[model samples]
Target: MRGRFGVHGGQYVPETLMSELGQLAEAYEHYRGDPGFTTELDSLLAEYAGRPSRLWFAANLTADLGGAKVYLKREDLNHTGSHKINNVLGQCLLAKRLGKTRVIAETGAGQHGVATATAAALLGLECEIFMGLEDTERQALNVYRMELLGATVHPVTSGTQTLKDAVNETMREWTRRVADTHYVLGSVMGPHPFPTMVRDFQSVIGREARAQILEAEGELPAAVLACVGGGSNAIGIFHPFLADEGVALIGCEAAGRGIDTYETAATIATGSLGVFHGMKSYFCQDDHGQIAPVYSISAGLDYPGIGPEHAYLHDTGRATYVPVTDAEAVDAFEYLARTEGVIAAIESAHAIAHARKLVPTLDAADSVIICLSGRGDKDVAAIARYRGHTVKED
Candidate 1:
């Protein structure tokens, strides 16, 4: 009940992990309010992780769309090149306070893994990362980056060999050695304090965006858009805007091919209510209740389930989730590069693709903020391959 977001989240973890989760929840509550912790965390965010990321007005794109003014919340500019760093720094610091000597995490596209390894190196903690074997291939550069930061990257080959499998292996690893280790779960999925805790850490996006947009436009935007894999970036920017009913929350899911096909990861579009990965949320599952294999061009958006709080938001009509196909996302990925001179991550292009659709319908006076979740440098080679170009690595 403590973790439930209208019955979507709970401690569906193993009994052996219950006590560890409880202790984590308790420690999070205490340290979150502790002045020393807050001060140190704030300083690290500003000095290390590059807090207060810019909110830039996309004048060229807005004029081309010819309707709503477009603004980009530039989380890509943060250290390590993604919004993942925010949550990793918070969790790794908390792990230190709890006297954990090691930190382990699950990652898909490897942004979270890179970020976690960075924080662990900074805080002097031993780090291990579990990534899907398939993703390790798609994101080989990130694997090297993580290793350079002193992390052991374990490629998981089980259960479709994707984000879902990575989570499973990380959870099992956590259960095996809970005493001296903390699991720095990458997204807002998972049990109890995690969804809530990760949201709080990532909410800096929304808080800064809200202030910046108001100062720039003198009013809240018509909508805030972010791509949802496990829904960390979406919830991060959506949380502070929840009370402002005028501001719409939109999450773009990866429709790998299309929602009509089995090869898609649009959980909100094609999934049903189910429990998986220690959270009761919408998941892509088959007739027998087994998790279905999911696909997305962007390795970051390949998860089969969304965060539990996102399920609550969808059920309550506080947010709208829509599917964006690989074709459409790739088009937007290239379009943004040509139009705005910005090379956005393929994961973020899903949101940009939807914004291209939505902004055309809104009035010219209206504005929309899209969370540019990460830099596209890691995705360029993969994106080139997706577009039928051969990428020769050195």
Candidate 2:
């Protein structure tokens, strides 16, 4: 019950993993409050991962929209070029404290894998990354980046050969060797402690954004928006704002083609309640209860399920989840580049696409904060292909 977010999260893992989970939970509880651990993690965040990422006012975009003032929480500027580094550093440090010699993780677009590899290298831990074969092909640059940081990349070909399959393979690997290894789950989607833990690590985004927005505007923004794959970035920025009744939490889910088509990965829009990947959450599943294949132009947003905490937030009306089609996201991706001279990740463009829609409805005096979750360098080639441009790689 401690892990359950209104019955959406639990230890749905195998019995063999129960004890390891217990040990991890205990260690995390102790280290989370331990001053030494906190100091080291804070140092890593500030000096290594570049914490306190800038919150920039998008004046050009705001004027173009002719509605609410727009602000971008620039997590894209962090080291390794994504918000994934926040959770990765924390988990890898915890693994070190637990005396684990190795760390393994599952990644989709490979941001998490790259970040995990980075942390493992910094902390002197052996690292392995399980990624979908489809994603490996889509994000080959990131695979090379991970390898450069000393991580072995395993491409999973099971299931739909996507994020879900990567998670499955990583979990299987963990079960086979739990004694000297730690599973650095990439998102807030796993069993107990993980969703809560990852949220805590990533909440730095919301905390800093809240302070910066108030200092700049003298008030909270009308809404905070972030793209939701497994919902780490959304929950990170949404958690601190949960108590502010005036602030709205919005999660933009990937609607690959459209929610009407089977190719969509908009879990909140098209999925039903189900248990998968060690958590009970909203998943894209067929009528027979089998997980359905999901698609998104952004490899990062290709997951078929929303995190349990997000499901809770949706059920309680504390947050609103909406679908952004690939066409719309790509448009936003390019629009941001032209308008703001900022190349946002395709994953983050989903949120930008939603913000383009929502900001138009709000008063000019109102403001909205969009979490620019990652830099777009890794996606430029794929995005070019999506736009019918032939990209020749060296």
Candidate 3:
């Protein structure tokens, strides 16, 4: 638990990054031992980030899905309206405790950027977010949100102008300014302590899911599901349920078209082992072992690699990973919006897509929990454009 979870994690960065990770690891360990860190984080979650987000029974949706009970862990209801805040606050506070004056992060779809910006604003930490140029164009509202919250946004114009490029840019910046800056990676992926540390910070979802489900049903669920992008949201909700024999953890990867040939970011479903952005994990790579271009209707799921812990979980069969196609996710997104009046993030819709299939297979008495990772407002335009239409506000 102290080091890499097998080969999936380590300080595999350039020699220049060794001392940087070492400094961060030492500071993080020191903060972990400090009660003040715990107290501050706890108080923030209670008063600000909305700890213990509700687990609501989606009876209508379950009934529509052939009568198997389904519950939603409403992480979408959090302060910045996503599960990202939980990790952001923790890392930003840790950065402060480490005497870092500024915090920086790399983001794909801008959920992490908004969350990091919110944390920076709350703690008065100077913050910068690196976003792929394409994503900045698509998710302009999030860019505006970050700027409004006092965080500077840099567009990553390198390497196809996508998430991978953003990550590379952020790491380069971190390496150049490691003295008084901390890189708060926005996922359960990345090198060394980041994967482990982010998971610990995000364990609140699983912790809440377990208690809420038991309180509602007097027993744990048959399965728990979350969409795996960089895998933080999924791991956050799956880790606390790993030992339960009756409970299965399902991580849904994005199959933008299908996993077999093209247009997918199904890292564990179809990816091979490779190194990208400092960590060796399952990644979508071509025949030459070069990182392949990824596509997804959901900006958040359009990444080539998943988190290291997810790689381990997939291999051990402790968690099952299935690819959910963009078409399938879109269908589910519309279904949930129409049925429950809850418009879901397309990243979140991947989990809901799985639930649509999972519920029907379960007995009427069986129940499943889905992590509602974030709200859908940021996705409305993307979803509309993908559908070749506009979504009229309700």
Candidate 4:
């Protein structure tokens, strides 16, 4: 448990980064419980970022799917339109406490970048974001939003020109600017302290959901589901329920086209254990250990590797990981929007896709909670184009 989840989590970074990583670990430990720090973070979370997002019972959608009742942990309603705010606020505050004047991060779908930029602006920290050129195009609105918040966006052209490449570019920038900049890693992956630190920040999701659900239903849910890109939201909601033996923890990964095809990002489904992105975790790698190119309709879930804690959970059989195809996710997205007026992020729709499958199999008395991680306004254009329509963004 010391900076690791079983044998999977460890710092696999360059020697140059080791010292900074050690210092970061110490600083995070120190400020994590300081009253002044917690007080400020709590105020921001409540007054600015909007904590305690509603646990909405999706009655119409649940009835339409024809199974157990469903509850949605509406992280999509949070500030910046996702649960990414929860961790960004914490890390940006940590950066301020460390006396850093600048903050940098890697982003894919732009939620993390926007959240980071918003935090930096609020804290008066200079911000820079690294994103793949492809993602910049796909998520153009987010890129513009970051710039509006006064953050520079670097569109990376390396590797597959995607999330993994963005991570590489951000790490390179961090090494050169380590003295004046703090890398606000966006997920529950990366090195030792990051996975643990991010999980702790995100654990608020699970804590809130557990209390809300228990109060509403007067019983524990049968299952809790969340989509897993690097598994931050899943870990956040899963952590509080780990001790409840009857409750199942489920993570849904993106199966871009199909799991059998190379054009998929179903790491737990087809990945092998290897080191990538600063941790020894499961990654989409070839026989000789070369990282594989990954794909998904949801930019946020297209990464080749999963977080080490997810790898540990997979190995120990303490949680279940499943693949949800892009087609299925699109169907769920449309279904939720139509049935419940909730336009879910494509990344979150992956979990909804699987929930549609699982709910039918369970008894009507059972219930499942899905983490609706972000709003879908950013994806409106892409979805409209995919569905053969012309829509204008205002």
Candidate 5:
């Protein structure tokens, strides 16, 4: 598994960053086996992230929807109120061990930026976050949160003023200032060790989902559902279930308004194979293979492409990708708030909305588990704007 599926993950950064990545790879490889590494992470998960986050069986929602069994992997309740901490903490700690004094990150919705900043604060490392100028404006609260955690926020105005552009800016910064800094990519979407390492860090979700489901049901669930922006949460919960023959992995893409809409960001459904951000993978592109701008109510899900590993998984037929529209995701967001006392991030709501559609078609006894990737605190205003109303509550 070297690149693409296994052929596309080589270190593609500038020459200045090559040694840093090499050292990082070596450190991560060593930590991959060290008991102390596992124990440290476990302790953090227990004390910081609240490990073994409840996999609550949604009796009300399931019964209300007409008897289909649904379970929620409650990642929204974690510290920082999202699954982002799982990977960020691991990477930040690894960065500290690598003797990096500065941690730099690029963010779209700002959750990952806030999470990284939080870890940096707790560990006493200098933190700097680069955010898309538009995203910083749209997700101002998260921008404030990052600043509160002592991260200096740099607004990037180049290249669509969005996530991809933020990535470009962050990479340029890393390339120029390779030493004493570590780039904490937010998802399992980057090159080489990032795809494998971030998945390893976030895999705790699936590791718990598997046992929780089997112990509660006495059998594997029929399907696993998660949203795919950069495809981190999907990869987290989908990896452990990949080899399971009976468990179907369904990843939902953000379909802004509709898959056919000019505003959609349904990468797997409408995108073609192309190169983006140092990887040869699926991308939403024009006839000339130039990248297309993407839009979604959830800023985090507005990227025009997905992770390379996801491209591999899709091609191998290990999982299926479905599109969930912004309207449907908002509906799901409200439904969760009304029915389950949960306000899901629009990114996660996409999966929840897709689950809403899938459950109606499945048999009553068929089970589906949805990864509630994050809370919606960051998106309340946007959701309200989309609904043409004031946000009612936090």
Candidate 6:
């Protein structure tokens, strides 16, 4: 399997897990390029996960912004309300192909957890999800959703109670059950096969969007943007456009309060190169090189380390990664809801926020497409609280 995205991705897991990883890598490499596997995945994507998500022209938003034409690659409309289902379906199917009986994953905001649960249910595989205790509390709706899908949810209470901790716990669980279990890693981070596998699964976004945009606008857009949360959705949408030098690949990172403050998840904006989570990548860490506590208004972005591909992209300056503050993301979330009747996940809003800033600087003929990664229904309560409102539940 292709690893080391320009010196960033590699299998750095514990020695005990190397064999498991090697087996997975071999299976993935074979299945990924096989026509039978491709046919099955394509059919499942169309019938179950809703393939070919829309490329909607956000007319009102573009007009309001008073600059470039704006289009939204609507992954938000996918089944399970996020682009996460794409990878989950592929991984679960691979697990079945590998004769694995169970699948497990770690989630931060619960999108991945919900998607994993949905895939496992559809595939008739036992599923377990590890979510940080803090995430479980913040995303209780998703926790219940997972249980409803017949997956067990384990709340991890260690290490800032966030995405990183959930990953640590999931790796531990995988180590214990390697023979019968496949860990459905949620992002383009982690070891070699996972980053490559997840990215290939997600590349459908960019592939479709590229052709759709060209058909609609008669040319490639000036830029394609997506919010980075362990960089799955971003990588999914970015990988296809990598060779098109005319199209800029932009990733928006969460600046919880601001990059100036310690409470931020702007990994590329302020992180240093380090190793964690079985990959060599940039991470938000302290002077002593310990992973630092990270914060983001969007739970999905609250992780210390980013996907290794993102690290490589940053290093090569092939992609531009910038910080989008919580205030900006929140404002964009509300703005899209009011102006375009679109309620986007706070994580997705980070990209929209950056788009707001970027679009105004471009000509009207220029176009920008943002990967709307998920619906905001999951973040409604949190948004209300952020705006100092309370929703009374019946």
Q: For residues 1-394, what per-residue lDDT tens digits would candidate 2 score against the true structure?
A: 6799997999899998999999999999999999999999999999999889999999999999989999999999999999999999999999989999999999999999999999999999999999999899988988999999999999999888988999999999999999999999999998888999999999999999999999999999999999999999999999999999899999999999999999999999999999999999999999999999999998889999999999999999999999999999999999999999999999999999999999999999999999999999998998888888998989
**Which residue pairs in candidate 2 collide?**
none
Task: Please give each candidate's TM-score.
Answer: 0.99, 0.99, 0.97, 0.98, 0.97, 0.99
Best by the lDDT measure? 1
User: Residue by residue across 1-394, what tens digits does model 1's lDDT show?
Assistant: 7999997998899999999999999999999999999899999999998889999999999999999999999999999999999999999999999999999999999999999999999999999999999999999999999999999999999888888999999999999999999999999999989999999999999999999999999999999999999999999999999999999999999999999999999999999999999999999999999999999998899999999999999999999999999999999999999999999999999999999999999999999999999999999998898878998878
In TM-score terms, candidate 6 sits at 0.99
Model 4, TM vs. native: 0.98
Would you list the clashing residue pairs of candidate 5? Answer: 2-6, 3-6, 3-7, 3-8, 3-9, 4-7, 4-8
Clashes of each: 0, 0, 0, 0, 7, 0
Q: Which regions of candidate 5 deviate over 4 angstroms?
A: 1-8, 391-394
Clashes of 4: 0
Give a tens-digit lDDT track for model 5, residues 148-266.
Answer: 99999999999889998899899899988878899999988766778889999999999999999999988888999999988999999999998898898999999998888889899
Candidates sorted on lDDT, descending: 1, 2, 6, 4, 3, 5
User: How many steric clashes does model 3 contain?
Assistant: 0
Mind giving the per-residue lDDT tens digits that candidate 6 earns over 1-394? 3589787888889988999898999999999899999999999999988889999999999999999999999999999999999999999999999999999999999999999999999999999999999999999999999999999999999889999999999999998889999999999989879998999999999999999999999999999999997999999999999999989999999999999999999999889988899999999999999999999999999998889998988889889999999999999999999999999999999999999989999999999999999999999999999999998644
How high is the lDDT of residue 137 in model 2? 92
lDDT of 6 at 178: 91
* Global lDDT scores for all candidate models: 0.96, 0.95, 0.90, 0.94, 0.89, 0.94
Worst 10 residues of 4 by lDDT: 1-10
Clashing residue pairs found in predicted model 6: none
Give the Å shift of residue 44 in candidate 4.
1.0
